[model samples]
Target: MELPVVHYSKSEYIETDTGNKVSRKSVICGSQNIVLGGKTILQTGSVIRGDLKRSGASNFVVVSAGRYCFLSQSCIIRPPCKAHKGAFNYFPVKIGDYVFIGESSIVQAAQIGSCVSIGKNCVIGKFTIIKDCVRIEDNTVIPPNSIIPPFSVYRGSPGKMVDELPESIREIYEARCKDRYTKFVPSVDA
Candidate 1:
């Protein structure tokens, strides 16, 4: 199926390549500092913010989206402070290919590998490294600077490696990505 060409308001500020699809409702603030790569799809209501650096420049929020990666509704991507002018400035948020970021999650200064699934309302802390094929459950909080070993299931507050998820559940989650939903706005009754 051919993807529809949507008119996004912050067009001048955003640099989108051909074949890369972003929903009209997805917002990219601090556009001067944000970059979206080819074939990436930033779904409805996702927000990308960049902080001010000490040099009076904007911090760079480098989002390297691998082919077929999908960032769902209301996902927040903020650059690390170390990557800015502050003492806490850190590196950019890098997401690998075929990764899925669930609704309403916050990903800051973290490295997410390919085929990983971050659930709804999850908070990925600064400088955290999530290895490939990891599955994080909904509402989980991953601490800063922590390492999540590859091919594991992490759940609960300050997420920890639980156990290998059942193959059935894993398959279900993976299949969910096939049906990506766009936002719907209801009309007012006059």
Candidate 2:
């Protein structure tokens, strides 16, 4: 039997009942290696490259995102690469819950912990480890193999930790993520 082909509006994204709003235009490769936890929102033009598999390991996962993660417009999430014992290998990019990746940001980090806020046009270098509750300002360039400690505010080129994040903003960021998910509905043109 043939299934009916359903066409959606230009402004409409693929919204599941679990509140995961993924844009139809987004390119998500290597589905087997990519994991999207419930209530995740991948906005328009986002590119998630999970097809770049690990060396000599066909069954390894390339990318994973936890609940309420928002990948904004034109953002590119790629697996980190490294040289282990003179052999190049691609590592997984693991993202925790309540993460917001801003527009046109290129992330090649190995680990991005919970409640991380990355601003627009940021370039996160390969193998960078971002701990929980980190706030990265806009247009920052994080160096490779660097570690951002928890609750730190990072900014500028080569990304420096400017200040510490207040405990109060944690709740605010969480609520903002939830609210954005709820309001991230398709735009219906008149």
Candidate 3:
């Protein structure tokens, strides 16, 4: 898919050596524990809570994102937390390549597979696992501990599997994420 060129102010972004374009307005806590693979985009107002880690664990990664992932504006990517041994501990959040998380979405998922497109204002609850080639519709609310299978379209309050996706969705979704990344450019007037 070909996306229209979207211009952003050059001063508002920080392009890393590994080709990750992160908005300065985004709040990324505990960056040392957050691993963003090459060519990922962290848009304005997005929050990655890498600060939340397992209790008493050292040098643990809280959030890991793969290449060409796009986190839209105001989205929150936080690890799921649960009580363990009478103490609260946060788990890791793993996001695969070419995943696109839409605006205002709150993801507390344990894992999100590749080629997934999550729509705007959705709430992916804690410990949820989303498999590859999945599409989540806007305003959907997935319950905690849910496991979404591959090649499915999920929506609604409990985020049920509403439809099935084609096998070619992996290629199509990857192309869409690549196009979106390439089209998100900086304006000429810095």
RMSD of each: 6.4, 6.9, 1.0
lDDT, model 3:
0.96
Q: What's the lDDT for residue 21 in model 3? A: 97
lDDT of each: 0.68, 0.88, 0.96
* lDDT tens readout by residue for model 1, 35-85: 555556677788776433234345545555565566778998875555444
Q: Write the per-residue lDDT of candidate 2 for residues 1-190, one digit (tens) a residue.
A: 2223323364658776766778888999987899888799887799999998777788778999998999998999999887789998888999999999999999999999989999999999999999999999999999999999998999999899999998887787788777777655544567
lDDT by residue (65-108, candidate 3, tens digit) is: 99999999999999999997799999999999999999999999
What lDDT does model 2 reach? 0.88
Model 2 TM-score? 0.89
Q: In model 1, which regions exceed 4 Å deviation?
A: 1-17, 50-61, 82-90, 165-190
Number of the top-ranking candidate, with TM-score as the measure: 3
Model 3 vs. true fold: TM:
0.98
Clashes of each: 7, 0, 0
